[model samples]
Target chain A: MPKTIEEINAKIKAGKAVVVNAEEVIGIVREKGIARSAVDIDVVTTGTFAPMCSSGIYFNIGHSKPRIKLEAARTYLNDVPAYSGFAAIDIMLGATALPESDPRNKIHPGDFNYGGGHVIEELVSGKDVCLSAATYGTDCYPRKKLETWINIRDLNDAVLYNFRNAYQNYNVAVNVSDKTIYTYLGILKPRMGNAVYCCAGQLSPLLNDPWYKTIGIGTRVFLGGGSGYIAWPGTQFNPSVPRTEAGIPKRGAATLSLIGDLKNMQPRWLRGVSMQGYGVSLSVGVGIPIPVLNEEILAHTAVTDDDIPATIIDYSRDYPQNLPDVLGEVTYAQLRSGRIRFNNRDIPTASLSSYSRALEIANILKEWMNQGAFLLSQPVTPLPGIESGLAFKPLNYRPVERNNSS
Target chain B: MKVSRKIVLHFPARLVEEAIAYRLVKEYNLQFNILKASIIPDSEGFIVLELTGEQEDYDRGVRFLTKIGVNIEALSQNVVRNEDKCTHCGACLTVCPTGAFEIEPGTRRVLFMHDRCIACSMCLKACPPRAMELHF
Candidate 1:
């Protein structure tokens, strides 16, 4: 029988629960089998530290004297534009948001010293940011403009409300074109000499719970070194991708929208990243606890690097127009070997994800659970696992027919 | 043995106009590539070149130069990366000709093998955080 949430909580408080990280539990289950391990282990922890481009933070800055209820406003944080989509002083700054001075669209990489990512890291590190905003004067609150410096302490609700984070799987990028291409995939060597993949592999949360059995709404997590929770199903949560017999997606699939506090986060786990020739992104550290509700959950945690494999893609083929070709499928163990063979030669690989940081986050969560400071919460709702995929309708521009009488 | 070495060839002030490069290849059968040369205009002269040739011919070429009072010294400048400042972003990985920078499987930290480094100094510019430094 599966252990109840109350039982797990009481066991944690009494310091009698068996909690092991996903990587460690895999070894234990391999020796004892899932049937035996499920009855023994109470929870499994999974972690990852990767650059998240679709991330942002919202802050409610303190009001300046005279209460600027300005009709229109523009603002910037560390040279990057912070969208003024909210009331008076609340703003949301995205990781990839660039300065107005930059002339880059989505295709070209802009050469800039700092971006939104740096501003977020500076705030987490307790550094002040140069905040500048201009507004048109209003009748009730007549403040035309304001420029000052502010830190995390000066904000009321400095919450990291990232819309998307933690991909289930990612593509291994390489350059087949003659010219070196700069992308979020990092700089790829010409003719596929080097390939880069970003993921914690065995330690990734979504990979651990591939089917979303035990991970869902209300699940408490370690986000950016602070305690956080999953807000909703992440944008682009495509569960319709082809899967292995183990149910893990062979390509990029599920993602999680996360919300956390800026005050509790640490600068060490939150670093600013700039992909040369590309845009800026934030390195987010996240860890989620998977409750061992039954033997099924144990089976998921038992999955290791050898059990998970992803295809190597030639990114030079404009994804939709030409479609990326699968060079070959290799297990995570082989990918982590530092080199993999494709065609006739061995190509060196680099990871955009930090394996060391992932391990650190996992261990930190283990200590928290063992000390009874953290408790497991049953998911309020299970994630969608529909077999069908979502689609968009095409535009129609045909002329109206009037039986040739008009 | 066939070998390549970065050497500085010191020339006497009077030999500044001598065709030493042509004589080394034609007379001594030495294969050389000039890396740097600053024959001071009408003054003391010197040239830096990577010399490669057969063991006997290399010996003969060195002897010929030394007999004429031309000094030679191996270049010693190298690339150094500060572990404390390196963020291990791996931007320097692609530009390295000798594969000196590699990721450790266990920690995912970029490992710098000084022995494999050729001191090309390409990584010095590729590094975003400016962690790489050239030491002479």
Candidate 2:
């Protein structure tokens, strides 16, 4: 039988309910060895363009010319806290374009064009929230970095607590290029054909040394910056790659891979594939320790620019095209011969940042489990209705302005 | 005018038949009453729960369960939809614990009723085609 609301309230007020100290709960998680659980990260991106202005509107009609023109920008960012055995995060990056080629400099007269950026607000904890910048370098703003700390043992609790607290400080920095405003009929107009670029990246890094080794983990290389171009009309220019400190080309085609001990890997458990819409796909995989599956070991491998033919005998493979028949035949022969264990299909490359985040979260959770500080909480309600696999959401970080001039 | 809040306590479906649910009620001296106690199958497996009490009581009840090694999460009212990218695989059908999905007879596409969804995310893991997504 359901207790009356009044009675429940009275019990709560009387302190008769079970209340465990936060530290005690942490201790319980550590003792339970729940940190060995692996964390998976996923990322996604969507893009849209600013609509073209009507010819009559640009020329100004007989009645009254509009002064300010507004464009509708449709974008969304989704972040879901860890509910069950898994947690997910999602973010959407978007922008508007200002063209350089136009007969009548209607919009703004400036040497450089303009593009819009996105801002993300996250709820970190029940009481404390933090906002991080989601956008990188652009004409108006410098490149921004986002950072987050996860409590591995109590991942579910920590995530929910952090999300609520982190969201309170949400603010995104907008870029405004210095351009002369041109007006017609007392209204300012933006130049036609000007374009803006928007991009998103996924980062998931497997921290378990054993897992890393099993999957052939490689060195952590930072891919430099680049603007993302939508494959739609009204795009003023092609996406430009951001430069790196080593003067390496920031943008271009690239291939990455993980190689390690394949003997003890659980290929069947690996699931799904996703990619960054704007930039090169950042793909990652980790190997499980042989003796203890809970222990993850980072692997060592090399990602080359050369288009190497897929090796049929490898434990797992990810490629953009079909493998050579010889390699495929060899791989099949090896599988039948018990030379390799390949249970899952090929997983495509994903966003580098999203993969990195997932790895980081997984590693932290593992550590917490090792310390017996992690615990799995039951859900009060069922999971969400949508079927999109657990998507990884990025942390939104913004820059804080310092009043140095004072 | 004063606003009154109710709290509810929920137990997992697996523990419903066991004495644990009753023990929790007796030990805690909880005023909350069990609403629905049953075992339900989800994508991950089976889960049991006992829904009892008001909103405030619910929050307190979660804390109480947390003390006993049971986890609790709040439910939000949000409708999620997949854009045109969905490939229409039937993976989501098996994951819906509440029987929220129905097949459109003509198209054979899966139709979703948000009201019945418990949001356990079993279908997301079961999907092989990389379609089917959740909206905020």
Per-prediction share of native contacts kept = 0.14, 0.05
Model 1 spans with C-alpha error above 4 angstroms: A102-110, A320-325, A387-406, B1-95, B114-136
Candidate chain B TM-scores, in order = 0.62, 0.43
Cα RMSD (Å) per model? 7.3, 29.8
Give the DockQ-based CAPRI class for model 1: incorrect
Q: What is the TM-score of chain B in candidate 1?
A: 0.62
The alpha-carbon lDDT assigned to residue A152 of candidate 1 equals 92
Write one digit per residue (lDDT tens) for candidate 2, span B36-79: 23444431222334345455554555566677545444443233
**Using lDDT as the measure, which candidate wins?**
1
lDDT by residue for model 1 (A232-350), tens = 88888888877899888888888889998989998766767666677677878899988888998889888888877777877666542456467777777777787778888888877
Candidate 2: TM of chain A? 0.18
* Residue lDDT tens for model 2, A198-300: 1111111111110122212122111111111111111111112222232221221111121212112121111122211111111112211111112121011
All DockQ scores: 0.21, 0.03
Candidate 1 displacement at residue A64 in angstroms: 1.1
Worst 10 residues of 1 chain A by lDDT: A386-395
